[model samples]
Each structure stands twice: as structure tokens, then as C-alpha cells.
Target: MKTAMLNKYFNTPHESGLGKTLYQFNGLLVLTFFILTFLVWGGTGYSAGIMLLLSPLALFVKDRPLQITKEHYLIILAFSLMFVAHASAIYRGNSAAEITDLDQPMRFILIIPIFLYLKKVGFNQTWFWLGIYLAGLICGWQSIAYTAGEYGTRVSGPFNPIIWGDIGLVFCLVIGVKIHHLIKNKPQTLIPKYIELSTAAISLIAASIGVILSGSRGAWLTVILLALLFLTIAFVTLPKRISLAFTSVMIICSVLAYAYIPTVNVRINQVINELSSFELTSSNRSSTGLRLQMWYTSIIAFQESPIIGLGKSGLTELEKRLVNEDKINNWVVTESSQQHSDLFDMLAKSGALGVLILIFFYYSTMKAGSALIPPYSSTIVMTTLAYIGFGLTNTIFIGMNGTMFFLVFTVFTIVAGEREVTSK
Candidate 1:
């Protein structure tokens, strides 16, 4: 009986007046959410709330079944596993106060309904791309405005500098793919090819500039990675001369930034100096030193409880113990609560189980995204790569802004990609 109900629930499409109205409204919400995501504080959270609230209304339309598929299950299962992993860790640690941490994982689970709603409503891929382009422009201008103030060496949006720069860098990758799509497929009528091409090129430049000015060394590395990926793709798909020209431009830009941007130069030298001088017991206070120390401590914590791991309270208690035992510096614990890397944070707090779940989540995303057509597939894969890259040096999963941005953008791209595939 349950199987029958589920089959009935997943078979029908909403074609009624109310269904059409709900679909259009959801489309507008999605577009507006992306446009204001970087421009306003808590925008991603706000959008999440609205989507969760609105998704249930579809059930009121008689015979309006959810448009779910194997890909949707992959996404839903991945998120559900993340929640289970964290919940188990928290339960084992017996940390009632850390219950609030469940909120992030819960957001991922709630996205299951949003995915159904979006799949049924049927998004127009154009809106998604437009929102991305406009958002990139806003981020770029914000970066420029922040730099103009000369408040500090780095610039950012309303969010933290790392998250700000990371978003801009991802925008550069998405826009780069969009430009590639434009070049591959000529347009007709309303917008001239040259003008569209020029606008996209400008937006890509703006986003790159934003990433540079934000002064995140990790994001800078992502920029280099993106350039390499683009060059590789270009060589595979385009003429040799075009690929070489693009590579030369990237090299020139990198050189200019290194020479002219004090932040870039200083940061590069700081990393070199820190790496050369770093020792496990050196009481190093620099950013790189602190991260290395925290990572080492986290590994110790992981080793003690490899299964479910130590929950937040357990990790906190262990940190204090380590500090007292002189295994790690006091400054390491004082500087931040996180291990500065997503994998390490999970290992310390949730243990190997959490790390396994996180890996599964990433794998599921890539598996689901494999079906997307050209530029969209490349864009989705690159965005996923950016998250993995950023996670190496920073805790992308622990922060509200970073995690929310990843979840929201990931879902939007998946929905948009699916729609684009069906439309073709």
C-alpha cells in the first residue's frame, strides 16, 4: 500500500491553474534568491526558508505527484547520510548544547522537498544563468567598492573574506563556461552575439578581480586551478592557437597580480616563510602554523575515536587536554573552534563515519551531475571542485554562509541542468 501511494504520488504532474501559479512564483523566488545571495546578509538562509515553506503547497493540487528520479534520490540520500552521521556523533558525545549544530545538516535534508518542487515546477535555464551573471557583477562591484575604501589589505562582500572571495572565484568559473557555451552555440534575433559575448567577458573579468582583491590565498589557488582546467578544455575542444593565447593571458595576469598587488606578494611570502619555519612544537602563531597545528591535533582526536569520533564537547575537552599536555599550542585552540579544514573538522567532531559520509555526499553530487549537457556539466563539476579545493585549507562545512551557498547553488544548478537536458 505504501509503495502504491508513493508510485501514485510520483507519477502525476501539476497542470491546474494553481499549479501553474505556484510554478511561476517558485521560478521568481529562485531567480531573486541568486541575485541577492551575495548582495545581502542571510540571503541564502532566507531563501531556504521560503522554499521550504512554499514546497508543501504543491501537495494541495490534486494528483500533483512529485517529479522524482534516481538522481534526486542520490542527492536526498547523500544529505540524509550527512545528518545521520552528525546526529550519531552528537548523541555519542552526549552534548546537548551542541544540538544546535544539527541545523546545518537538517538544511541539507530539507532540500529534498525543494528538489521535488523545482523538478515539478520546471525551471527555465535562462533565468538561472541570468541570475548567476548578475550576481557575479554585483560581487565584482562590491569587491571594487570595498577596495576603494582602503579599509584593509583585503576586500570582501558582506560575508567573511574567505567566503566572499571563494564565491567570486566560482563565479569566474561559471562565467567562463557560459562564455564557452556562447561561442559554441550562436544566438539569433534579440541580442547580438558580440554584445552578449562582451557582457559575459566583462562579468568574468569583474569576478576575477573580486577574487584577487579579496586576498584569499586559497581562493587564489582555486583561480589558478580554474585557469588550468580551462586551458585543458580549450586544448581539447578548440584550436591550438586559441588555447595557447588563453594560457598566455592567464600567465600575464598572474604575473601582474604578483608584482602589483601587495597582498598577493605578502601572502605568498608568508606561506613560504611559515612552511620553512613550521614545527609541530614550535608554538607558531601564523595562519599556516596554526592550521598545521590544528590539523595535527585533529588527527590525534580522530585516532582516539575513529568510529563515531568525539562530538563538539569531546573535541573541546580533548583540545584543552592537548594544550595542557603541550601537544599543541594554547593559541591554536584560542584562534578558532574549527580545524581549518572540512575533512579535519569532521574527523575531529564526527570521526571517520562523518568523513565517509562527507565523501559519499560529494560523490553523489558528481554522480548526479554527470547527466548535464556541455557548459552546464562543466560548470557544475567545476563548482563541486571549488568546494573540495576550498575545503582543503578552510572549513567550508562549518560556516553558515559557506555551507548555505554551496547547498543552494548546488541544488539550483542541478535543477537547471536537468531542465536544460530535457528541453533539448
Candidate 2:
């Protein structure tokens, strides 16, 4: 009787409990940390910095598991080296010239530690997935609203125009998979089933609409890639009946999307027309000509400094000179623009060393991803492949939201590999 009373007293909220208090606070800390991450990117330095500072709470909790793997080390090495490369730019006398330039590399010091700590805590995979989906939904809704009256044209929401659409599309793909899973396992109870179906249906429609309104050809290409990946995975892993049902659903969705969504139809037609009429040397074509010019300049910059390459300072100087000489328009000039391509940008900024590190990183990740089997492996592989495909045309590492998304996904991939090994 005394022991029972003691147990009840200890567990009570008013009690100065040890384990209970710690558990409750730890849960709160985790929730707050994720919320901060979602809101604190995109130049929110104070908020981001505070979140990073608070991340150590996860590390401080006793008995918290750490799940670092060889794959994690390789991925961390790649990003760390890139951060070092950016910091090296400071030595080139660029640090004092541009506040924005200094901010990115300086901020890296803070971000790296936060990610390290998060990994140390064995952060919940489900929370990470939920965060991705929620971020996507918010961004997609805003994007659709922004482009509604723009006459079949798409505009970025809060993100920069060039890659916002791509980010949104990737988010949609992730969410779509989650929704499919929910639908597949929906409860037999009518109320729960209706709730699940209605929510999934609404989100699916919203995401599709957002993709169409964005009018990003690159994103459209990515969507196609996603479809192919999904079909391949479903066919290989699912029962024949389930696979056929999914295929039918996808086809119906596609048909309905094209027939009922005006923005989608118009955007599809636009993509077709652009591809059919594309030219290698068309100064009048904004997208193609601008990308070519950026590539040309980036190559020239790389040629000049093949070893360490021109740091941020050199790129800035080149942009200024190009602008003065009318070699390129000012709108194409980014604050920290290199080649829009991730690989080429590495070459331009960190020279051969950066390229080699990135190559090693991606190869290691792909190897790790390939080792896993079935649904999880397929999901990670497809998502990683999509990022790679998108990275060919867009540099994601420097962008605020893109970089965070990349880091989060990379961590999850490593965790997934760890889980697979443990399960075996």
C-alpha cells in the first residue's frame, strides 16, 4: 500500500518527478526544435541560431540512443568539406566585402553542430517525415494562391522563383507516397475511413494543383521521373493485384488531372512546345540562353583557378565585370551564383577537390541506399535519384530551404540504412 502510494505520487505532474519530468520536457523540446527548423530558414538568423543552441537538450537526455554509421560519416564529410570550401573564401578578401557572403559560411558553423546533435539523439523518423509533408503543404498552398490569377503561369511562393517549383514538386511526391500508404491501410470503420480518404484526397488534389500552377518544366520532368520510379517500385515489390490497382489509379489520376486541371494542361503543352522548339544558340530564349551564359562564365572561372578556384570574391568580381561589359543581364546575376548545376558549381568554387569529395559522398550514399530491400530502400533510392536529377539543372546546396531539406533527407537515408542493418 505504501509503495503504491509512492508510485502514484511520483508519477503525478505536480510531483518533483525525475524520469517523468525529463520525458515530458524532452518531448516538448523535440517538438519545438522541429517547429523552429521549419520556420527559421531563409535568413531567419536569430531564430535559426536559437534553435541550434537549443538542440543540445536532445543530446543531454540520458539513455538517448546514438545511431551513427559509416554512411553518416561519409555524408557529413562531404558537407563539412563544402562548408570548409565556403569558409576558405573568407581568406580571399571576400569576407569583408559582402555581408550575405559571410553570413552563409558563418551560419554553417552553427548548422553543422545542430545536425550532429540531432543525429546523436536518434531523432524520430516519423517526425522528420511529418515535417517534410507539412512544409510542403504550406508552401504548396501559398504557391497555388500566388499563381491563381496569373493566366496559366506559375510563380514561386516564399522561395526564390528558379527552384521553388522543384522543391514543391519533391514535397508533393513524398506526401503522395505517405497518402498512398494511409489509403492502403485505412480503417474499416466508416468514420475513420472517411476521414482518411477525405484528407488524402484533398492533399493529393492540392499538391497536384500546386505543381501545375508552378509551371516549372524542370519540376514537371521530376514529376514524370517520380511516376516512373513509383510504378517500377510498385510492380517489383507489391502483389500483382495491388500493383495493377495502383497502376490503374495512377492512370485515372493522370487523365483526370489533365482533363480537369486547366493549369496542368496548359503547362504540359508549354513544356512540349518549349522542348520541340529548343535551340542551342537562341539569345532571345530567356531560360536556355541565361543558363548557357551562366555555364559559360562558370567554366571560364573554373579554368582560371583549377586548384582552389576563384573563391566567392572571384565570382563576385566576374559577375561585376560581366555586367559592366553587357556580357549578361543583371537579373541572371545571383547573390552567390555559380553554375546553376551542383556539380559545376563545386568545380567553380572549390575546384577539383570539392568535386572529388562530392563524387565520393554521392557514390557512398548510393551504395548505402542500394543495399536495402523493398519499400524503404525503393523510397530512399527514388527520392535520392530525384534530387540528383533535379540537381543537374539546379544548385540546391546554397538555397536555405533546399539545403535544410537536403540535410534532413540525407540524415534519414543514413538512419534508414542503419535500421535495415539492425533488422537483419
Candidate 3:
């Protein structure tokens, strides 16, 4: 009887024919979604909407039986607690009407089921990496446009300024791996090989230019980290000869580029100056200083209501208080926004509980990812690390675009890695 039930669950029509086509189509759609996401929202709301829409389809088309692991249960429990805490805040009127206004919280709820379905379908590592490369290319083009002054002086691309930095940082990793892959391969045709190399080179150059043009000191630091990670991974994984050649080429190119490009030199120096001069206490220093103040304010708010805190719209209320106290600058403080730290924002809004859940969510995802490392594992590892690094400075996961990319790509990376192991 158990065997029969298992067969029934795995033997679904969706595994082939229309279902198979749909599955492949959805993969393509997922790729398109990532490209547009960076170009549109910079990784925020619209991206989440795309994932929400597909989650149900993924659920409906799934041929395999559902399997919930212990980690899955933990995540669900955490999310549920967050929901309950927010609901309590809403009931107590601790949150503003506007904070309770949108469907973001609801969307996160919907994401739970979708994420489960995606876990079942899994993904191919190659496809996942390809998607990242495509996203990098699109972002690269936008960066070039910004540098050419086709757009604003600042490199805003499709996403907001903050997200643009994150996108650029991720692209550096995506492009680096792709270039490495292209160089390693010797295609049958010279033309195709040349084309592949050219495309990879262009993409890398574009992303590099974009990173520089972004004027995001954090992002610049993030890209440098990404480059180092890439080199380290290659040194550890690849053959000695290949690693040496790749490292040599990279160093030579870097030296040549730096020696000739005055603009690049100027930008690097400017970033160094900004980083050196940055202060945590000075409100007048820059946004980083403001962020430090906000962090302090959030900690104080968290202490006031350590358990559940203020609610979903808690930050808005905190911002109002800060403004009234004249603690925040008039020119910078606004009616809608709060501090830039996502963790601190959660602490002020949802309290310690919410922050704990979020940290757990990221921790579990990373843990899952850690067990699935291999040929493609390094790429996933680097990309995920880059996302986390960027998140420290910017709120990349709260909005639909950011949330969608974060959840989808993260799940895809794990699924793909697992699939590879199982196949072996």
C-alpha cells in the first residue's frame, strides 16, 4: 500500500508533455524575472509579485509528494510567530494605518507555500548560474548607459540607488564565474568561442564600470570582496596550471587597467577617502552616520518592548519621535522612511522576536546551502555571501523585488546543488 501511494504521487502527467514544457518555460520565466527585477525595482516588490504568481503554479504542477524537513517546520514556526506579533501590534494600534496599509506582510505569508513548492521542484545549477549571468549582463548595459550620461549623473538604473549597489556587487560574482567558465572552455568553432569570450568580457567590463559609476562605497568594497572570493575559490578548486594562468591574466589586466584609467584611479581614491573619513557618531558625516544613529535609536526602542516590540509600522512611529526630538536632521528625516539597517528596522518595528526570526531564516538558508557545495557550489556560496554583505548596508529583502530575488535565487541555488548531488 505504501509503495502504491508513492508511485501515485510521483507519477503525475505534469512530469512530461505539457507539464514538462511548462516547467522549462517557468525556468525561462524565472530567468527573465531576475533580469527585469534588477532593471526595474533593483530587487524589491515587483520581484516578489512574480514569485508569488509562480508559487501556486509550482505547487499545482508538482508531481512529487511533499516532504517537510525539520528546518522547514522551524521556518514556518518563525514566520507564524512574526505574523502573530504583527497582528497583535495591529490590534493594539501600535502601528500606523499606513504601516498596516499594504499587502507586503500578506505576500510574505503567501511566499511560505510557494517556497515549499519550489523546494520540491528544485533547479539545475547550470541554469541557476546562467540566470545570474543574464542578470549581470542586463545590469552591465545599464551601468554603461549611466556612465555615458544617457541617464542621470548617479547610476540609478532600474532599481533605487541603494539596491543598485547590491545588484552591482552580485553581478561581479556572476560575471567572474562566467568569464572563468568561458576561458576554460575551448569551443569547437573559433567564432562561437570568440563570441562567448567577447560576451563574457563585455559583461565583466560593463559590471565593473557600473560598480565604479554607482559611487557606492559599500558596493565598491563588496565587489573587491567578491573578486577576492572568486580568486580564492579558483585557487582552491581548479587545476594548478589553470589557476595560475587565470590569476596571472587577472593581475596583469588589473595592473594595465589601473595604470591607464585615470577615472578608475580617481574613483578608487575617492572611495578610500570616504571610507577613511566615515564616522559612526557624526550625524553630519553622511548617510552612514545617520544609519549609526538609527541603529542606536532602534536598540533603545527594542529595549522598551523586547518581546513583541511596536508592531509592523513601529519604525514609522520611531521616526516621528526622532523628528520631534530634533534628533534627526530636518533635511534628511521624512514622514515615510526610517533607518537603513534591515535588522534594526525589524527591531524597532517588530521587536526582538521579528529580528530573531529573520536571523534564523538567513541562518537556516545558509546552513542548507553549506551542505550542497561542489563544482557550482562556490558560485552559489559567493553570491549568497555577497547578498548578505550588501544587506548589512541596504534593505534588499523587504520589498517585492528584493524578496523575490532573495528567496527564489536562494532556493534555486540550494535545489540545484542538491539535484547535482543526487544525480551523482
Candidate 1 has an lDDT of 0.76
What would the per-residue lDDT of candidate 3 be over residues 1-424, giving only the tens digit for each residue?
A: 6776444323323453544554455465556656675566544344445655666665555455455667567656655654554445454554336655434455546657656755655433334545666666777677667543322445756655456656666667666765676677654232356766676677666666666666565565565676677788988999889888877887887677567755456555655565577553344545555566667677767987787666645655665677677676442345235446667666766787767776776666656656664534555666667766666656555555555566556556655565321211
lDDT of 1 by residue, 272-321 (tens): 99999987767768789989988987898889999877876788788888
Score residue 30 of candidate 1 by CA lDDT. Answer: 71
Candidate 3: list runs displaced more than 4 Å.
1-16, 42-51, 54-92, 95-102, 120-127, 148-153, 175-202, 224-286, 311-326, 331-336, 373-376, 420-424
Per-model TM-score versus the true fold:
0.87, 0.69, 0.71
Best by TM-score: 1
Q: Which digits, one per residue and each the tens of the lDDT, describe model 2 over residues 24-115?
A: 44333434433443233352233334446666665554444556667656656666676787667545746466555656555445555655
- Candidate 3 — number of clashing residue pairs? 9
Ranking by lDDT: 1, 3, 2
Candidate 2: lDDT of 395? 77
- The residue pairs found clashing in candidate 2 are none
lDDT (CA) per prediction: 0.76, 0.58, 0.59
**Candidate 1 deviant stretches above 4 angstroms:** 1-15, 62-65, 148-151, 188-190, 226-250, 282-284, 420-424
